[model samples]
Target: MEDQRIVNNEDYAVVLIDGVCHLCQGLTQFIIRRDPAGAFRFASLQSEIGQELLRQGGFDGESTETMILIENGKYYTRSTGALRIARRLRFPWSLSYALILIPPVLRNLVYRWVAKNRYRWFGRSNECMVPTPEIRRRFLS
Candidate 1:
């Protein structure tokens, strides 16, 4: 599975997230629910593939506590990452892309505030999220 995840970079989008973060895990699940076209692939930041991707993108894996979107060889982080994912989701949820109009500094201010206290506010999981068998193939970790 790890080998499969390490293939040559392609056109698909990959989401890299903190494996034990409850909020991040929940956001992954939310994306799965809304990504009916299977437009995304996922990996925990702790996974080998996740680490490799971050390295290739020149990002510090340990320092990236927020969700990350890797698309067409570019990486998007913080609120930008979230909005990119949201724009690809189905139906009404894609409407969330409208929030992109807000200044990135303002958006990231709120994002960083939530992220700083995410573990205390949303808690953590001892293990990474386990996708249902039907959707397990979509996850790389």
Candidate 2:
């Protein structure tokens, strides 16, 4: 197991995703690609660091269907997390934040559907993603 790594309450955001889900890995890569400024760190939802962040945010840390964003001691989940993270990205991606005006119930319905089918549709990794040497520091252990 990776060590129990902890993220500090800094300006940087921390994202938690299902480690084995292909869609999640792709999303993480997309974030890294779009955010050249290195504004976020990442951990698997099954990781100790991810659990700690969930607990700190008052969530039970068992649900893995939702993306999570931890920033400045606050946490956002589901569509909110997705949109908030998008707001930090570049170009057309940042435009996604405008969707926040949509009702969350409708948005989360779509999110949950995609999340539920992700592994089936996109496959899964046997283990968490291994960040490349240059980006390794942006991933929590």
Candidate 3:
């Protein structure tokens, strides 16, 4: 699928995450809650569209080492992506974007640790999350 088919650059940002990771799914839910305006859309890293997006971003589609945020025609990965997502969230949550000043090399060190151990700590789903009917529009097929 084409990027435009999933998200219009001016209308929404796309978050690509590990489909079966419990933590990743929870993070999506968290963002949805904080973003009443629904500025973000989601897809699993394992999905075809996600792979295509990854390829377009010059990444290996099979790499699920970090979450990705596609916004304003650019792609950010690791802590930078997380911080950029936070910057778009509501009030107190948006404050987390301040952490961006910490330097990505330092920030990503923590992000990588959590990502590497997420499945062991938070467990995993047998399949990708199926969005509930209420939020179905926020997810890409």
Q: How does each model score on lDDT?
A: 0.84, 0.86, 0.90
lDDT by residue for model 1 (21-140), tens = 988888888898888788888988888788888787777869556888887667899999999999999989889999999999999999999999999999998887777898898887
Query: Candidate 2, TM-score vs. the true structure?
Result: 0.91
lDDT per residue (tens digit) for residues 47-92 in model 3:
9888888888899978788999988778899999999999999999
The RMSD of every model to the true structure, in order and in angstroms, is 2.5, 3.0, 1.4
TM-score of each: 0.89, 0.91, 0.95
- What does candidate 2's lDDT look like per residue over 18-123, in tens digits? 9988899999999999999999989888998778777776778786888888877677889999999999999999999999999999999999899889989999
TM-score of 3: 0.95
- The C-alpha stretches of model 2 lying farther than 4 A from their native spots are 1-8
Error of model 1, residue 124, in angstroms: 0.6
| Number of the predicted model whose TM-score against the real structure is largest | 3
- For candidate 3, list the clashing residue pairs, or say none: none
Candidate 2 RMSD to the real structure? 3.0
Better of 1 and 3 by TM-score: 3
Cα distance off (Å), candidate 3, residue 58: 1.0
Model 1: CA > 4 A from native: 1-11
